[model samples]
Target: MTISLNKTIAYTKNWKPTFWIALVLGVLLSLLLITLEPFDNSNSFSNKYFILSGYTLCILIPVLLVHPIENYFYTLQTNRWYIINEILYVVSTLFIIFLFSFLYHFYVVSGLSSFTFASIWDFIKDYGVPFIPIVVPLWVYLRSKYGVIEVPLYDKENHKKRTSVTITGNNKSETLTIFESDFVFARAQQNYVDIYFNTESGMQQKTFRSTLSNIMKQLPTAWQVHRSYLVNLDYLTAVEGNARKRFMKISKTEETIPISQIYYRALGKRLSNSPQELQN
Candidate 1:
């Protein structure tokens, strides 16, 4: 839990911490419920507080369980029903929350009272409506304190599209093929295209007698940022400076790609400064 407090997890690192946090949240919620007085008008203030705490425990239990399940959701293999796993997580969480709400009302508030969907729905609304003002700040604080490095839940096959492109020479014999993800950027250099790409060691370049336009057809993550330069948006980090001049920075490189006034506006509109430039 300490290792990933900022990021959402199923449970806290220790039972003590979980108990303490839950107690604090539960006390605050009890206060809120006391303020609202959304219970049987016949119940006294003391009884109302007691009843609200039971409902609060129900909310906390499901929250603790759901976060951990969601945290590990990205590990599901894409070929083996990733979408189904995601759906199950959501459905199961909702079911648990609703079940707990109904049970709390049945056992504690009203003995075998006629439980209806409307009653459970009202409980859900009261429980979840304060999420923005309450939970969002808590979420941000946890993330800032624990360094919540969010792992994107994109399908493995979708995130890294491993495509093989066959590059052919004028002679029928010579050919070279490359994966699209490795490509960084390409520049139009005289008659040949200077293809810059990422490597295990560092940035590497290859000269191919190919037009930038032709090479771009194979690169889905690439965009024509300038007349001379085509940038692979996947590795792109930021665009700095004013409209007069701008610098485009890519991941793992101190050097910045120049964006000309000719293409600066277009590049700004088409690509974001974030690394997930190709993300939908």
Candidate 2:
């Protein structure tokens, strides 16, 4: 019990810790129940054993129900089936545990010719209480840490067509035709985004809507290194880190975009861990 509780508390810092903990506890408790000699020579149900049995049910049943139901609520649509799902998880877990307990109890009775429900239940009550709350903190911590909430894009029109936007500067209104493929990088400045792309002549610049958050979705899977900037993961050539700052160098571009310190670790991890890049 002590070991299970301690591991649960510590492991809750990461995702799915309770699930791992519960599996271990279930096996350990079952083994202990099976091996320990029952003291029910009198063949009478005792309060001590009753409590233990209740606890055994508590440990496995709630965890099974909680994990699946929690995942259902978190990912899938919350329908009337949610309550039913919870019930099913609990019942299924209990049914399985009970089957094992029944088989082991029968083996014990057959082996020793002495066994009672009280003794079996006692072992259960003692082991199950500590495991229930372990699920909560584990779920909460994991959800908070890794679940990035994404805002759904409101796609009103199915615009299969691609066109160009003209950039009007102080002197001339240069009409630039940009194929979505040729465009490399873009940054928002107030209501305008200075777009950088390779042209026939050389590199060309243009200004367009600053609300590229929607447009960005149309682009490839790129990491938003900073609030103001998003860079193509493939284009990222080298990551430079100093005492206080970090920057990423994009291919075919000399300008090094600054990456926020908060995202440095994540960016570095992604760069080092993920494949070279899967170009869509």
Candidate 3:
């Protein structure tokens, strides 16, 4: 049952910003880091290095760790829960940074005293505290441009013309000649998309060297009814329910597509909104 909540999630998919916003944020953060208070006996050059290092470790680590986890949750279509996980991951990363710094000073960094609760608390307040919160959203924004949170879509709006796409696999190149109407569905098969389509003669299958999300955008306005499946909205002629999956009956074909539970709502909504009414 492709239903309400799923449609909401699909519409919000691919909420990535333009490149200019990322470029501006990067410049601002760099400038902010350059102007922070200096430590005693540290030259401007060395201070810059310390700030960069702190920013990288304290800020970047959390982002790097959390991004994959975020994607996993997004694939599961658990949007709200993923947001919660991101917040907890960021907070936890900040604590880890503080703990590691204290340990380093005590056991490694010379000219520093043994770790203490008061010192650790002060260090967190001084450095780890201010930098962590500022970095997560900026990183998320930048990374989203790379297709991180995007969902797959295909439908009639893109069905007219033949699209020539190059597919490379095993260091070899192959050309995929397709019209948006010819495609029935596609799936992310490991590093590639396993595509199902139709020709003037009969059904056909091909492997393409691209992700499902990337391929989805090129498709006509079909909704992604499963994390792995992108079906042509026009082809969805009938839907039959099953305990685990809903079998989708497509136009002019008896082959039914499987609709995963996660995408049911989004797919249903797209079907309800006649594809002819959707603006290209």
Clashes of each: 1, 10, 12
Q: Compute the lDDT for candidate 1.
A: 0.57
For all predicted structures, in order, the TM-scores are 0.42, 0.40, 0.42
TM-score of 2: 0.40
In model 1, where is the ten-residue run with the lowest total lDDT? Answer: 1-10
- Clashing pairs in model 2? 49-122, 51-125, 52-121, 52-122, 52-124, 52-125, 53-121, 53-125, 55-125, 56-124
The models' CA-based lDDT, in order, is: 0.57, 0.48, 0.54
Residue-level lDDT of model 1, residues 1-280, one tens digit each, is 1221111222223344544554555566656666766656526445666777776776568757766555454333211112244346545754675577668766676666576788777766765544437643553344234322222222335538778666553345534566777677888776577777766787787777766655555554456666567776666667798867787887755667887664564456544332354322
lDDT of 3 by residue, 1-280 (tens): 5322222232122324323433444445445655664234335343445544443343334334445655565556433233344445446654765676555434433246565689888766875567656755664555433423233334453556576443344434645666656677777777678777778788788887866555655554435666677776656665679767687777645666787765565456545565443322
Which prediction has more favorable lDDT, 1 or 3? 1
Instruction: Estimate candidate 2's alpha-carbon lDDT, on a 0 to 1 scale.
Output: 0.48
